[model samples]
Target: MNSTSKGDRLEDAFYHYLLDQQDRGELIFGAYPPENCRIYRKKAYYCREREADVEFDVVLELYRKGRDTPHLYVIFECKNHEASISEVYVNDFSSKIGRIFPHAVKGVMVVTSRLQAGAEKVARNARMGIVKYDEQGLEIIADRRGSCFEHSFVRSQIFRSANSAKSLKFSAYHDGEYFSSIDRFLGSLEPELVDGIRPENGGGSLPVPYLSIEQIKAAAGKILKFADYESGAVDLVKVCQSLSIDLQFADRAVLDADGVAILGSANFGRKAIEINSHSRETRERFTIAHEIGHFCLNHERYLRSETIIERDLFVTREKDGSFNYERLEYQANAFSAELLLPDAVFLKKTAHFRRDLEMRDRGHGYIFVDDQPGNSATYDELLSRLSTHFEVSKQAIEVKLKKSKMLTDQRKRNEASPISRVFAGLISSRKS
Candidate 1:
């Protein structure tokens, strides 16, 4: 193949590989506990020393939801080329990892090419696992190139090509997919430095009075207005418009087709927020509220750079508002969920309807299935009636509950027990 054509094909394949993994919503981390954590790729990782030697596009830290996880890290490496791996290469990568995230407990690597001599052996010897992307596909996966998103990459730790975006969309928004499980997982994450997140100034912060779930929701409610007809897609569109951050209600051909993001122009006019239109009666509303969290707290910092990392995946950040992939992803998700499902709403919902169903630390027994504001008080009913009304999903609601310590658990568990996804495959996903 011509050099240009070869590069183009490689690029196409590279993205396709990412998208396919994205759709499946997971990665094959390894043979041990952290082995099964799900991974969501962001812009990539970079750490500049002084002025340059600045590391270029490295794979973001892999992700995995630990059970009652106080904090667990999913470390990973990515190399997109067709070459064999080896002891020298693995050792070099390992040494680099040691320097970067010194305290990290574990890590994984993605060699999207042939494994070099002694590479697999070295990885195995190091007690790490290797995933190879070659001419062939996963022997266990039926779809092979078609793809499936578990967001918990432990299934088959290997790949050859990417799949349709639809599969990932399914993993992201569906009620029963990885997100729901993530809700459960989040429900279990314990705070590191547990204490009141109060700031020095008491004039009420931009989004809330404090760094908390209740405060975030309260902040969102103050900023947004909801309409009764805001169901499916229309309501989400209206919410986005009401906020003034900028968004459109575009349709998608998926299960959680709440809305599709237009990618560029990030959130209408601003370059930070991506303009996504969702249609889920409950989910779309929650998404709108969630995006509001981003606008209120993160937009400006992000717009300063063309490469906005999705979700605060990394827990680390720089002064100029740049951060690692995992931190950004986690922050964005937490911010959104906090705003959509605040404690005030939860309290009221339980107050009015506490008599009807059984409430537990993780979730309520009510199977709220409303396409709009009426039925399924699970989240909407609770939030709508509270001082700060915002629509959130039961999963998100549960997550909010755990984060606020409404429920108590302080350990992160790497969930390896396979379960069906909340929603299997769809495009426009936010990592499972």
Candidate 2:
């Protein structure tokens, strides 16, 4: 392969491999806990010596325990071709990582090709670890004090290859299937963390602002009007980009979806919102919108303030059975609903609701035309059609309808309180 292609593949391989490691309970480095680190790819860091910036293949920021504060920095540089890693390149890379990061930094060199005769020695002297990628997976050739370099180098410590090498005791994953191993690994890790830490009761916690039905509708209205979405649907990817939120798809085994917003220095680079590639197209879009909601609503700042947020998971619940993240989750859910199912578009699309006399109840009688007769059947059909038209799940459409008062029942759906009614009316007038 060409140099550019090989370099790109190596970067991708290491970034993904490290993410799986983080997902698993494996220690990323001595100080960088698996659960507390954030990984960035192709990130540029400014070098004091050269007065110019140099980009690393991957930069992993390890956060302090129980806080969002970043504690340590680790950088990885990858080479794919057989070109030998020279001592000069190792020194230069080490210098850049050290100069760029204010905290203690560890430099890692990962290469598909073998290191030169003296390269490992040079890297080790510089406190850098060298990893060589092979058909069997990754092998760490140079040991360093700060990292789990020795553990990763051994045959037992290597990531397992999909075809074979499954017998290795410490191997958490199959080599080819890097992402699939994440869920199994994460499930085990969560119990350990939860057992060690007490659940936050949330009494003194700041209440997450509620996104009322009309407020969410207004948010959606603003987006559609700004984007000029006279059409039924909006290009969410484009919208996210316009808002400076990075939307990405990652094939993850453990997580259906997740995202993060970087609050650190810009030199470290912009953060991204990741959707699960394994999810269905509709699900992917919804997840992206959900994460976008988190970003727009400043949910990450709240999450990072107290404790670390796990992938595809929330923090432990309060004693009263409310989640520490319940309000944040609700806000994001509301945002996603409004963004995907604008009141104008959603109402227009489902305007032709046919009366289902089969139910024999007035309130529950409405069902979309061509939908089946029974509640489950009819709702399913409505969900399917709305999901298709809006490119969201039936559940999402249902939430928007019920919240906006379009779908209602006396018992299941509460009447909007006076305060809520006033808030909704105010939001509607402002939007108009």
Candidate 3:
């Protein structure tokens, strides 16, 4: 599409996003109720200094009850650019909003990409908020009545400055503070709202204890027994039903995420899991099982909001090869692996497939994987059979095998050469 079309699309998306928040009673601006909040697109305001009407991409007007005039005005300047937005855009937006509405007005510069060097400083100096809004990143994984976990998560990601705009679902920055969603940004504008908002259960600041493989297996065993599951593949749908958790699917971009687990709480009565619709049935099944794992492990105590499980969350190691036991994501992943592939059933299936494929080696104690000029085909066949039987991804099956110590990966060993090990040690030392 053309640049103008793209810009317009972004404006529309943002406008609707605000409208949705307003409808949900989340767009709080200085105690203004949802009915008193007015959102407009392509709104024009008269500028006395310029003696002409200045147009805005999107506008939010908050009025008191029974009053016609709005007490607060929020102007959004949308910039949909392929490159990073420069300080010039922020300066221009600040100038226009300053000239048009001098009092009780807030201006926000929203872009599709990151800000150029010095752009954020210019925005902060001008007392204007900056929002990096990628349409693909607008998916909602989790939310709570008054939780700040999402805000904390977004702030951590923003401070890292490692993830691109597409990697973040939503982020807002104002006066050195980061917000996770637009509603939170709006609420921050008012001191009263800021004081009123409290983090639910300390806002996911507590560390999750590391769960051993045996503990995860026990949890999965109870779930399987509860579902009366004695089958090849664990039926996630039946399991969710038995637990009274709702399962849903949505057609979203793959970059958005794999799935989200919304845990039941006093504020939010029902538990639900939303999986991104995908063509790969195995992938979808794995996502479902992963969310179910969260529920079975009672992660709601730590995760107070909706927990978005991305592909990267499945990784349990840091770059230096240290385990991240503080994150519930690792625990959930372990539970998912056990729930999908039970020990007894998985071991029996693996042995049967290995025998059927004649993967036995007198010299090696375990099956070798990705070994060239050897039994690579046999290992692949074993993975395929196990993956098919469990209705999970081959990668998942491979991880399970390594965890079970039933296979040896040559590729992993090759990657961990002497030089790499030295570098990894140096990196770990530096971190320490």
> Each model's TM-score, in the order given?
0.33, 0.39, 0.71
- Cα-based lDDT for every prediction: 0.36, 0.49, 0.65
Order of candidates by lDDT, top first? Answer: 3, 2, 1
Give lDDT tens digits, candidate 1, residues 25-101. 43321221223343343333344433323232223233334444323454445555444445676787767555554
Tens digit per residue, CA lDDT, model 2, 283-348: 556556656666667655443211112222221122233333444444554565568777666777
Best by TM-score, which number?
A: 3
Worst-scoring 10-residue span by lDDT in model 1: 418-427
Per-residue CA lDDT of model 3 for 345-370, tens digit only, reads 88888888888888776666578765
How far out, in Å, is residue 49 in model 3?
3.7
Cα miss at 40, model 2 (Å)? 21
Give the runs in model 1 whose Cα sits over 4 Å from its true position.
1-218, 225-235, 249-288, 304-327, 356-391, 400-432
347, model 1: CA deviation in Å?
2.1
Against the true structure, what is every candidate's RMSD? Answer: 20.0, 16.6, 6.8
Find the 10 residues in a row with the least total lDDT in model 2. 259-268
Backbone collisions counted per model: 59, 1, 1
Q: Between candidates 1 and 2, name the one with more favorable TM-score.
A: 2
